[model samples]
Every structure is written in C-alpha cells, then in structure tokens.
Target chain A: MSAINGQSTNGSTAAPGTPRTGGEVVCDAMLAAGVDVIFGMPGGASLPFYDSLYHYQDRIRHVLIRHEQAAGFAANGYARATGKVGVATSTSGPGATNMVTCMANDIMDSVGVVYITGQVARPAIGSDAFQEADVTGISIPITKHSYLVMDVDDLPRVMSEAFHLASTGRPGPVHVDIPKDVFLETTTETAPDQVNLRGYRPSKVGNARMVRKAAEVINAAERPIIMAGHGIDISGAADELMQLATRGSIPVVSTLHGVGTFPETHPLSFGMLGMHGLAYANFSMRQTDCIIGLGTRFDDRAVGKEDEFGPGAKVVHIDIDPAEIGKVLETDVPIVGDLKLTLQKLLPLIESRDRTPWLDQMNGWRRDHPSLKIPDSPDSVLPQEVVRAIYDISGGEARVIADVGQNQMWASQHFWYERPRMFFSAGGLGPMGYALPAAMGVKLADEKQDVWCVTGDGGLLINIQEFNTLAAEGINVKVAVLNNAHLGMIRQWQEFFYEGRYMGAFLDNPDFAKVAQAFGLHGVGTSSRDEMHEAIAMAHEYDGPVVLDLHVDRVENVYPMIVPGTGVNSVIEDPR
Target chain B: MNGTETHTLVATVADHPGVLTRVASLFRRRGFNIASLAVGHSEEPGYSRMTIAVEGSAEEVKQCEKQLYKLVEVVSVRNLTGAPAVTRELAMIKVRVTSNERPGLAEITDIFRGEIVDVSKTSMIVQMTGAQSKIDRFLDVITEYPIEEISRTGVIAIARDDVGPRNGRARG
Candidate 1:
C-alpha cells in the first residue's frame, strides 16, 4: 500500500503520547472511515461523546432521532441505500437496548451497519450504576462482532476495526460499547492509519476451482433460474448479474431482498419468488433444472416447504460468507467471495446459450397470472391500486420504501424498480414502522434522490413519532399511507384460513390527515381512486415532507399467495 | 445415536480474553450436548488447544466444526470421530467395607491396575487412570460392593501420533 500524499505509510504521525480525549480519538477514527453523518441521540452516559461530536461539527454532522431504534433503522437505511457502512449511536441502558431489534434486522439481512454505544464507567460496569447496561454482552448474538472498549488507547483501533469488519466479507452489524470514563480520559497516542488483525482478515477472492465448477454447472443447466439476493446490491453487482442473465439467456427470479438487483422490466426477469410470490415464479422454482442462488441464504420464506423444494434442480450458491453456502440447501457448487468479483470472473466462463422453452413456460405464467395492477375505475381504491399509482406517478424512479405487512407486499408486487438501491424494505426481520425513519436516513444519505415511503396504517403507528423527526430535519420524503381499517395481512389470513374469524385483527385508525397536521406537515386523506392520484401528485409537488393517507379496500388480500405448510408451487392465484 | 455415543473434538483457538466464552457460547447456542471439555496451553505461543467430548448427530457434529471455524478466535476445529485416537480418564472411588472384604478390594484394584490411595476403618479410596471404557468396566465391578462415592474426570483425547495436522491453513 502506498501513501496518499506526503503522509508516511508507517502510520502514527501523531506524537507517541500526545494526550487527546478518547472521544476525540473516536471522532478522528470516524472521519478516517469517511463518515459524514451519524444518527444517534445523546443521553447521560453518552453525553461526553456527544459533546466531542459538537467540536467535530465541521467534519461530521450528527442527526438526532426521536428514538434509538429509529436511529438504528435510519443507519440501516443509510447503509442499504448508499452501499456504505451505516452508523448509529446511543447512550447506555435503555438507549442501547432500544437498538436491539434493528441490530438483529441488519444481521439477518447481512447489512453492514456500525453502532457506537456508551457504557457506564469501567469500575461501575457490573455494579448496576445509573444508565449502565451489558450492551456488548447483549449485542454479541446479534452482531457480526462486538467490542467493549477497555482502554482509551484502544478506541481508535476499535473504531477502525469496527468499520473494517462491518463493511468486509459477509457484511453485518458490529457494536462498540465504550465506557463513559474512557471517553473523558486523554491519551497522546496518534491513531494508526491502517488496522492489521492477524486473526480477523476476510478472504475476498473466490476459489478458482469452485468458480470453474459453478460455471460448468451453469453451462449444463437446461432450465436454469438465476436467483439473486441483496448481495448483488451490497457488492454493486447488478450489472454483472444482468451480464450473466443476458449472456446465457437465463431467467431471473429474486428473493424479496433481491427485488431491484435486476430490472423487473427485463425480458428475463420473473420478479420475486417464494411465499406471496408470483404464481409463475413459484412454478419456475419447481420446474427449473438448475437453481443459481447468488448472495441469497435460501431463507425459509424464500424456499417454502423445504421438503419439496427443488427436487431435481442442481443448486449453485455463491456468497461472500461461507457459512451460508450449504446451511439451508444441499448445494452442488459453492463459491465464496465478494459477489461482484466472483461474478466478474465467472462471467467469462459462461457460455451463451438459448433456453427458449423455459422462457416460453415462464412467459405463459407471466401472462396467465400477472402481478395485480390498479383498476382503471376512478371511484374504487385498493391497497394494490395505491402502490401501482405511486409506481406510475413516480415513473419507477423514486427510491421506494415499504413498512412490513399488507402494504409491503402490495408495494413489492406493484412497483417495478429499474435499478439497485432503488427499493428498501424490512425483508429479513420485517419490522413494522421501518419506512418512516429508514426513508429519512435514505433521504439524508442522498438529499437529491426522491424517497417515497409506502406504509400501512398499522405499520405507520408503530413509529409514528418519527414524523416529527422528518419535519424537524426538513427532509422532504413523501409518506404514502395505504390505510386499511385492519392488520390486512393477518386479516387476509383469517379470512382465508380461519373462516373470517376476525380476532384481534381489526384496527381503529385515527384521522391520519389530522395527525400529519399536528406534526406540522401537509396531510391529505382520500378514499376514492381519483383523489388518490391527486393526493400522490400534490404530495410529490410539495417542497417538504407530506403524508397522503389512502383509505384502501378493507379486505384485499395479496394474490399469488403460498399458504403456509404447502409447496412453493401450491400458490393460490386469487383468494375468495 | 441414542444421543449417548461419545465423540472427540479438537480445536485451536487464539489465546485471548473471551475466546472461551465465544466458543462455549456457540456450543450452547447450537444445542450441542458437551459431555466434557479440557483446555490447555498448546505448542504455539498465542494459541490454546481444547479437547471436547460431545454426543450428537453427524450433522450436528459437522455444524459444530463449521460454526467454530466461523468464530474469529477459533483457528480451526476437527472432529476425531472414527479415526484412531488415544482416549483417557482419571477417577477416584471411595468404597465402604469391613476388614474381611478389604483383601477382596485390594485384589480388585490390582486386577484393574489401580491403587488404594487412602484407607480407613470404614472406607478405602482407589485412584485409577485408563481408557474411558476401561474405567467404566472398572466402575461396573467396584460398584457391586458398598461404595461411598466416586469422581471421574471427563474424557480427553489426542489424535494418533502418526497423523499430521489435517489442514495446514489452520495452523496459524
């Protein structure tokens, strides 16, 4: 490695014992990692570090969120939207604990996000001092790696290491819990320019032998299906995926997280497949001769009824993490490395071939049972129609986010994204109330990009408090609420499986327009289809954040659904 | 497996704080029923060797190896399931008997290559070290007599002297 300018490559240009506060060292490390923004909230234990952040205001900006959980989700959104390591910070105790769900969510999705948390003084660690919590202990299971900073000198190394591990192989969240006293303590030691951990290096290059075998399998596959995942986006390999797909004439189906990794409008693209997947997509899974899973874990939801999944399909799984290679499915070829590099190497080995018969079969499924589209009627509005209208009005270019549940499925089914990083949702943990805060993070990461948050009434209420954060931050994201009077997904299930026994599914939604008004933002509530279009347009035209509450049909279920405990092919095209 | 068969696992780990916690936590999280575990300094300066006895299915054992390798502190792990290995255990048994049965106890100890380390009017303590099965058989015979108590160290194993390290990449 060569020095950038006149800087020495030997590292540590600062005097050996120059005394600087640990907080300063941490801030210095963050700047070295190129962190421009940090999402967090200050409290008793983390106040010292927050104060240090004030001094670094010229170099880094801190965005204060209402809740620590949203801070985490926003960081997650930042990471996912920008393909950078997102970061969140909070004080000790409840502040640290509140970020748990988001940490777990990132871990499951393999999103790289760093979380810095404050702890009680070292001496007060186990004594239950005020605002003290076992943050590192609690986070060990949810993070790729966790650290409890013991020495002030170790802060710089820990920060650099956290960023390295979080952004490297098999990217996931990492937490660094610093004691309050450490931040106040000063040391003169200059931070190192690079980190060298003997035991922590991650291998990024794929094995030539495995890639060769995978290529051979790909060439031989007659009815091969290219299944992509979030890894494509994480590795910035959407173009590589398209290269292979177009080169080989292979059909593509995505896991939920892989939705926009490949353009849905492509001739070879089959949209998302699995539970609640297109009927044709599920049929392709059963009929394919080869299953090429790229950066996907073959999650249970993605491979419904595992016992009957891919009976004859030869499975080829490629991921940066070796742990996920064959953890779920019996893979014939397993290649471990960064997806983009591996795909780049493997693309040359691929042979251009035609699979007209397979394409014909999938085309038949696409035309026979298509994704639900909005009805042309001006007086009727459904959740599916709301998503479709937004898709139409945005020209499929706005960065789209959806909260979990009915609105999520509706958006995923209707919206056609043309590029990677254009769609964001809670795919792994599927946390509700994720859209509002996550969208804010996305908008912060790319202020010029238009962000649209498509959420449901139930999902919105979970983190409704974040609307204030949006208005306060002056983020101009569009919030489109697909307001139905019930937890629509659960209600749909009860109607289909439980004979319409609506227990604990009904929701008494407040006047969302008034709630948006209270937050000092423009709000429009409309139940008719024409009003829905007008409201979306008005919200888009508004200079600041606007909420459009769309009262959709009360009991519309997502179509092409795969009932639980059934094969992926056993999809219900339409529900009564 | 009736879920009671014994298997041996050898792992090399970085000699750092909380490494044992991470390795131990992994086993517990994976529902691996560990029968015995022993950790000691290894030949390398900054690494330790751990010998663990586990009873689980083949898949679980494979998973145990894979999961262990996933931990940064764990250098490598190998399961010595069927390969020839040297297994040993140490035990101390205290037996209660009269003077008449004392001679019989001494003879039993000699037959099993054990020794009476402690003796009293009511009891005698026998110390023995041997293969796990040998110790089990020895216990089966001694328990017929009136035994006050017994304690046994769990099994520890090493690969046969002829076998070199299976994979050299893990030898860091």
Candidate 2:
C-alpha cells in the first residue's frame, strides 16, 4: 500500500506532518506513466495544478491552445499518432463545457484520452463562488465514465483509475474533475491502491452462442447482405468480414461510416447505403432477404425511412453497446458484444451455400451502373480519381479514414478495400471535423499501419490546428484534402434545391502548403492527375505529417443522389 | 439582455442540500437570474424535483443543460413544453387597482378563471391556474392597472395521456 509515484504521504506511519497536495500526486502518476505531452488551456480554477505542472517541465511538455476544445483535439491527435493515452486539462464552467464535443468524439471513435478538469473549491461549491462549476455532472453522458475527487488523499487512485478507464475496455475518453481546494490541500493517505475495473475487460472474442447463431444465419440464407460499420474496424474484424462475404458469395454494403469495410471492386459489393447512398446499393439493401448489420447502429442515415428499411429481411445487428440493440430496427437475431470476437466465433457456424446467382445479380447491377470512375486527363483530379490513385498505390489493404461530406461519399464509392476495418469515418453523428483527429487516433493505435485521412477542405479547416500537433508528435500520418474550396455538400444542395443561389457556400482559399510548411511538415498541392501517384508516394516517404491538398472539380456532385422521401431506386446519376 | 425572457426547467437530482446551491451557483456565475425556484420530493424518493424558471434562448437553455450534465447529482433534465405535455402553473397576483375601476375585479376574475383568494377594499388577490401562456396572457391584460406582489409556482408538466408510454420503457 505504498505510494506508487512517491508524491503523496497518505497512509504513512510517519510523524503527523502535513500531506502533499493532490495535484502533486497526479503529476507524479502522470510522470510515472511516461506521458510527455499535455494539450490544454489554463483558467482560474486550474491554477494550482498548472503551478504543479510548472515544476515537472523537464519531464512533461504542455501545449497551450487558443481554445480548450482544440486542446482536446490536439491531445487526441497526439494519442492517435503514438498509441499512448492523450491528455487534456481545462478549468471548470465554459472551459469544461468546451471539451464535451471532443470527449464525445473520442468516445464514439474509440480514442483513448485522459481528460482532467478543475472544479470550484468544496466549501464554495454551491455558494455561487466565482468560476465554480460541477464538472462531473456535465460529462457523464459524453464520457465512458467520470469521477469527482473530493478527498485529496484519493488523488493517486483517481488519476490511476482515469488512465485505466481511458486505455482499457473498448478504449475511450475518461474524465476526472478535481476540486480546487483538493488540488491545493495536503493529504496523508500515501498508500497507493491497485485499480480494479470490475467486469470491464475488452476480450477480442465474441460470445460463443451469438457468434454461432450469426454464422448459422449467414450459412443458411441463400441471398445474404453484409451491412458493415465502424465497429468492424475497432475489433480489427475487417479481414473476417471480407472473407465471409467473399467465400459465402454475399454482397456487402456499407453505411457511411462503414465505407471502406469492403472492396469497391468485389463482385458482391454494393456501394454505400441509405440517404445519399448509391442507388444500386440502397436497392440491394431493400431487395435482400437477409441483412447483417455489423458494428453500425441502424441510424437514420443508414436505415432510411425505418419502417421500409429491410422490408422482408431477416436482420442480425451485432454491436458492443447494448443500448444500440433493438434501438432502431429489431433483429431476428441480436448479438451484443465485440464484433471481432463474434466474427471469430461465427467462423465455425458458417457452411457454404450456393451464392452464384446472387453474385451474378450483384455483378449485373455493377455492370449496369458502375460506381467507380477514374478521371481521364492529367490536369484535373476528381475526388474519386484521387481515391482510386490511393487504392492503386496502396493496394486494397491500407486503412483509410474519410472525413464528412462529399469526400466521404467519393471514398466510399471509389476505394477498393479488400479487407474489413480498413475504412473509418464519423457515421453516427456525421460530425464535420472528424476525419483528421480520428485518423490521428487510429494511427496512434497502430503506428506502422498505413493510415490515410480523406478529408474535404471545409472539414479539414475546422480542426486544421491539429496539423501542428501531428508534427510535434512526429507521427508521419498521410492526409489528402479534397480542396474544392467550397462547402461542397451545401453548395450541391443549393445548386439542386435553391436554383444555384449559392449563399455562403464559397470559401476564401488558404495556402494549405504554407500552413503545412509552418508546421515543419511536407505540404504539396496538386491539380494534375498524373502528379497524384508521385504525391502519394512522396507523402508516405516523409517521416512526419504530410498534407496533399488536391484541387478538384467543384461542380462534380457525388453521384446516385437520391432525394429524401423517395425510394432507394430513385437516383440521378448526373444531376446537372 | 433587456426584457429577459424566463424559462421553466424541470430536473431530477439526488436529494441533497448542496444540489440547490450547485444549481443556483451555476446560473449566478453565468449572469443568469433564476426568477423563481421551487423544489420538493418528486414522484420518486431519493430523488428531488426542482422547477427553475429561467430567462434565455433555446440555445442558452441547451447550454445550461450541458452545464447541468457536468454535475454528478443531476441524473436527468428536460424542458417540457405545452404542445406535448400537460402544463400547469399556479400564480397569486395582487392588483392595486380599485374594485370600482372600469372593467374591474369582477371581469378580471371571470376572464382568468381565478378566484379572489384575498379581498381588500382597494384590491383583490386573483388565484389563476392554467398553462404558462394563459397566466402570461392574464398578467399582460392586467398590467395597465397597478399590481403588487406576484408569486408563481413556475411550470411543471408530464406527457399527455396518449403521447407517453403506458409501460415503463421509453420508445422512440
């Protein structure tokens, strides 16, 4: 029961001496964990902790951010590139409130981040004290879990618990709110307690019964379709999904988040499904008798007009979050557990069925309406062309993270990912500033793994401050921004819905190359299609962050555009 | 910031002394004035109900909820509206206008569906029970005349019979 970091005097039999402050213990624990960087902004409530941090400058590095929200993003990026837990600190009230979205983003994307915030002093907690806030209450729903540290002696355990919570289970953001007085007061409970996270192990294997049931369902069904989502990526079960689809001759369709889960070139692969989904893919979703939803919640965008989603299909929804089961479309069989484990368990239950006819039908649909198209000339590159070039260079196995909007659509429609877990995107909320930070998170999980961040100019700019975070972390993450210089999706809607009265759609250009250069990273711009291959190879060659701002054709809207309230088959390929 | 609008927020929190302070302090720090605060044991024990009528926009209301979520004791919070729920408010208004004024106390009582809880030679205390809008409208029509002390119960609501679940589960 001795102190782990030697910063506290708790539980010691020594003379009645005043104990060290909670902030000292926390700083020691952070140092013991080999943490080198913390991204945050300072405010009144957190002054004492910041003072403690000042003493640990030699061992730890702190990155000050203009906004606390960006601090969270920066920490996330650092964590993503190094596989270490990213850390963020902010004061209570507005500062803490600013971190909710970033924390929620981490939780949703499965990024490991330890977030610490300061609360008002205990005595003045509810007395309308200046700068005081109830940090623990505001973060519950957005975090994996949170703690309010009342006792200064409990600081070691609380900090330790926060780290464990952030790195363990499915990996998410964990928050610890420290009262100002607690951070400043001394404590004598020096014995460090072992962290016990009861019943929170993230086993890579699925429940045996559920896995067997899923396999049996897949083997028995003559015409089955796979609805892969982000969970497949988290579980690293993309390979399993691809093999099952290929061997069983099953067609695979992805929700927006599940974009690169299956290869675009696979015979049985349909494109992205639901609103703004490819026409044939949505049609296939409606026509298929058996739909297997993996890791994706049957969200509004995925299950367009829920009542008519899978008209007569036997749906099997597999996910880690139990709340999501039966959340949207009820499944004939529901498997609530880790996707990778479930798929591994499913291997035995599957028996090959005759899927030649299904494959043929899928091929026929493909032949009739090819989703992937490569640009002809060399001067201008389209989004699909850029994705195609990447696919050709990396083959079909490298993992890709696509940002929101048109670029996401293009990547979903163009990338030929031979394995599952290869595509990552913000599917549930369709959050705009998702890809770059998420890519950083993904890269941190596996550094050697080739990770590509496919983003639009608009989405990229939202969190572009992270570019410096990437450089400082020294993680060589590849970024390809589809620089259309417009809020392309909104402009597309205005073009179609409001007779091209483009209001607030245009954006002034930023010399992205200069921005990248300022971050001490390689930045290249390309309008010529021929230079794309060279640019991609050059990016991979660099040892740190690289941004390839590809100038693309703006008027070229993402195809198979289906108007809302209409069926899946209603689509316009060339809207112009 | 002038002519600030008041809002009604109903919250469920672990019944504790400091919770009220925590809630009030949040509003105070934000420069928001809590016009009226009413708290009592709710439908469930161990959990207390607080009806806080505030003044802000829809965005500000959401921001306040976000701030409230950061508090450990606040389990859930919501803004129940008139369209979907049964909204009820209790107000006791004392008017200084004479009983003999034009369209006086008799007409005001008849229109507000209120009783004169208290009667004096100069003024009458009108007890009105209805939705927030009704109470606001009643007050608006009577503002031209002198008014003394006014106390409102704030707004408390539950889902209408047909709209909410009969069973325990909440379905989307």
Which of the numbered candidates is closest to the native, going by highest DockQ? 1
Scored by lDDT, model 2 comes in at 0.73
Question: On residues A58-160, what C-alpha lDDT tens digit does candidate 2 reach at each position?
Answer: 8777766656776776566556445567888999888888888888788766667888898888888878788766666666666766777888877776677
Residue-level lDDT for A532 in candidate 1: 88
The C-alpha lDDT values of all candidates are: 0.85, 0.73
How big is the positional error of residue A149 in model 1, measured in Å on the Cα after superposition? 1.3
TM-score of chain A, model 1? 0.96
With candidate 2 superimposed using the best TM-score fit, by how many Å does residue A58's alpha carbon deviate from the native?
Answer: 7.9
Q: Residue-wise lDDT of candidate 1 within A53-138, one digit each (tens)? A: 99999978898899999999999989888778888999999999999999999998888899989999899999989988888778
Lowest-scoring 10 consecutive residues by lDDT in candidate 2 chain A? Answer: A2-11
